[model samples]
Target: MQDSAAGAATMKALRRRRGLSLAGTARALTNVAAELRLPALPAVASVQRSVARWEAARPTRPDDRYQLLLGHLYARTPAGSIAIGPGSDFAELLTALHLLGEGERRTAELRTAVLRAATDQGAGMLSLLSPALQAQLAAALADPARTTDETVAGLAAAVADVNGQVGTLPMVRLQLLLAPAVDAARRLLAAPVPSAPLQESLREAAVAAYTVAARLAFETRDDEASRAAYTAATREAAQLGRPWRQAGVHMSHALTTMYATHDLAAARVLADRAVRAAQRGESILVRARAHALQAEMLARAGQARQVDTALRLAWYDMEANHAGDPAVTSFSAGHLRGFEGVCELHVGDPATAHDRFAHSAAALAAPRELVQRAIVTVDQALARIRMGAPQDAVELLHQSVDAAAATGGRVPALRLRDARQALRPWRQETWVMDLDDHLLDGLGA
Candidate 1:
């Protein structure tokens, strides 16, 4: 729930980045204190209370020892900051707070950028580490206490919180955190099996983490890593024996085959597998997501009739309010409309696709939803070209290049280039030449 940097970074964000809950962080620090035989340690509750106050995420900053211990806890320095910004604005504001010497004021914040920006952009901002702060976070990761019911719950909650960030972050940076998260879950799972329910919870967390990792891999064009991660996720979910979780895994893998490899046959296999798993599961939301994925894949293959049937099934499942569904499903009216739009385009109905894309544009207009909007913008541009308006398509494509670049949407950025090539029939147009120059500039080509 918390966002923003304190003095360059917030302990809370760094703590969460390492897969610790507030209490887990406190306990980790306490454990570290015990191992070092440092003075009488604060009780976990007392430490947790302090951790909450420290999370004010203002420039008041934690003093030296606390900062060093946190660095040790997270296994890194530059532990002082997290993302929340209009770069220049946050930089200036953080500077002003430091200049005044001290104060605690909450600022509205967001981390979508941190997960989307280049890694150096995110962690490199906190470059003020001292020699004394160097320490291993591995100890805490190994602590038997980390697998307690409360801690396991924290792990689940942490991953769920992260998935909430999908569509906002860039594929590269999101994969960074997901790897650590999956590692933390693996640590818990490797511990001698706990109570059956806790074991199941750990498996689900591992499966969820692996699935998302695979998804990001798909986005980043790391086909081998994506494939390996999907395999791990499926193996774990099969052991968990939860149809819904396994279904989620299959649906995500479907995305990889559909986009990363563009292997229609492989995508079809995963989509069908997802639907079968969803059918055996209880969540309509999960089933809806599975079928929607099937519909989207079918759209890509230009299978009009099959796409229509799958879409109808997806919409039917979505009609109900399935409370407490996993955030990973990510289904919405707009998503379905976008799927239909893509289907219409593949089926050679540009005018209908344009309308559907318009609906998609509205749905993805939120400021943080830039990547989705950029993707839809490209589709809309393609539709425009198909409808005999290369100029309009060129204009839209220009804006999309910026959006896609800013959000680390390498895939969409590549698509923007391809969409520009679609204007070859109008190659003599001056605006098309202008668009070419702009694309070159954006690409540093």
Candidate 2:
């Protein structure tokens, strides 16, 4: 009973970290009861009150069975037939895993059963489980061979089931649940990582989480949070022990420095770190991304030859490695391409800049990403304006602003501000004046 009570307390803590409401927790419990074919009416109410009491300034008896259920619920995997009454030992095991970041030996035994259940009736698990479990399952399914299209389909079905059962949860919990997806994605890109269709789905989930957190940070101008999340994501990528992923983290950090803050020297240092890490891994894709970012930062510092050298490396690395289209970058490679093109123009190569911007914009077109799309769009518009296409530039800038507004992103808005400042002298020659006025009116910068 004491062990279960302790587990119950941990469960409550996880819920609090996730920021779930009592009603939301109750709904999740109700869904769990229904899935288990247990009595829902009073049991769910009991769980709800117990959870509330745990949250309050009082003490409640820790129910072992309840804590076990909560672990299974948060785990998103099948609890199997483990005896889970008030004195069960599973609660202690789970508590240890949560606090120590290491699951017990029994956790591995449960893995097979969990995988079987995730493969078979994963839909039920999804329906009865919380966001945290769903995220873990997404990570587990990231192997390509094991997680084929069928596997991804199963996982998606499970996610949908859980979505239907629990509806929307607190944003923070949802974010935490998605963290594993990001971890899984790094695995997919790593050298020893497995290739699974479920990996693609997991990648999509990770991207979703990044987009949300990045957008929130950009909107609130929370540079600290933005730096922290991006850095943490990079750390996760590096932990996967893949050169490309490590480089990708470096590139991401570089971009965060470039656009999120005004630290060019720090940005260059990060870019250097990315280049070195990618080189160490012998990952052509990673090297190319790092070089390209380096070029952008160098251009900012008025180093023309360095820009040329960086782009040269980018092109050469992609060609040598037979890498796939330079897909990954610090700030969405496709959009950063436009900014790179603008760098060429700054160094007195309008034609080259024009071509680069066009290619970059085409690559970035209609992405599902709100934040990436907006950043790329803003760069694209600026590139066009520099290339003497004022009308197209104006329209593109407007679209960029709209996209940024949708995500509530002040960083992109600030980028737009920089573009406007550059075109200040020609404000009357195009629609730049009106758009600039609008931006200043709302953004106050």
Candidate 3:
């Protein structure tokens, strides 16, 4: 087929219709190559990359090995499956293949529209982008079939970059970014790499992708989606067979179950799993966070003594923690303080909760911490209400809901609702009424 957008679109459609990743496509080629003992066949990694390049229909990279191997994989699978379904889709690919026809134009238009919706979301979301991001997005809009040449290291960086933006982007928008990224990482993990180290790196990247995916899925209030992402992440981390990796995965699961789902029993179990794994691993950060999560789980259960013990252990872990394990979860002293505030509130000590929350200023004040800041802001407001000064919480509650508007705003929206529930006792106060009006009014920014 000639290098054209329609050609690329047809190829991608065939693959998607097959419900396979790029690596799954690579597997078909490699399996055929091995069956025939095809000598000098391109490496599995090369085939995966070529599939990517082919699907882009880049002019410079004309197709090679356009023989039985490609036949067994692409051209044949559909015809064989057709004995089993869509003449309409195949018609598009076939007409597009003739290379300058009506089918080509129509197919490409629909493809571009769907791709733009997946990537850009909408003009309102797009308008909020920085000029540089907008330019980058413009290029993507211009070429729906284009993709980056992703190396293992490049994929890792992409995963890291997406994870780093967790709280910054709205949950729905973040899911859009993460969906393609996670697909890429999972595809790479499925492909065969030349070296053990490269394989390990891909596994690491996949776990990290799923970790953030679980958080975003949970934040979007899709409990089943979050569970599926966590299951995949834990499976990948287990395949790595590293305690630190498991620690990271379980810690993420613990946080989700505890905060988002309120599954305290499961949270306790996951938190203990994280602590055990961290104990056997090298990240002091993970160690500290694990204990802190354990403390929160216990606090929520009203076990004050155990909570204090866990909190003390976590403080020591943080004080002594100088370990930086990128292979593990990212944490900060701010996270520990937030955990302490949670513990304090759950243990019926609003004064201490307020005091503890003061140290979480960094979580609430950072520009990049949109979702997290809203969560902590709500917590701070709750502390004020619990301390018999419901009036003091109104301003902070307003700030929390405003942050909700700025972010994709689901997770924090729930928090804002629960905060409202907590304010029912003082609903007659003028400040409470105004706060209610502000929240009811699209959480005015």
Which number leads on lDDT?
3
Q: Which sequence of candidate numbers ranks them by lDDT, best first?
A: 3, 1, 2
- Candidate 1 minimal-lDDT segment of 10 residues: 127-136
Structure candidate 2, residue pairs in collision: 5-62, 143-196, 144-195, 144-196
TM-score of each: 0.69, 0.51, 0.65
Overall lDDT per candidate, in order of appearance: 0.67, 0.56, 0.68
Which candidate number would show the highest TM-score if scored against the true structure? Answer: 1
Worst 10-residue lDDT window for candidate 3 reads 79-88
| Candidate ordering by TM-score (highest first) | 1, 3, 2
lDDT of 3 by residue, 66-171 (tens): 3235433432334332110023343344444444233434443332222233344232222222233434434433442321223444555555655655555556
Model 3 CA deviation exceeding 4 Å by range: 1-150, 321-324, 327-329, 362-364, 443-445
- For candidate 2, give the lDDT: 0.56
Alpha-carbon shift of residue 227 in model 2 (angstroms): 3.2
Candidates 2 and 3: which is better by lDDT? 3
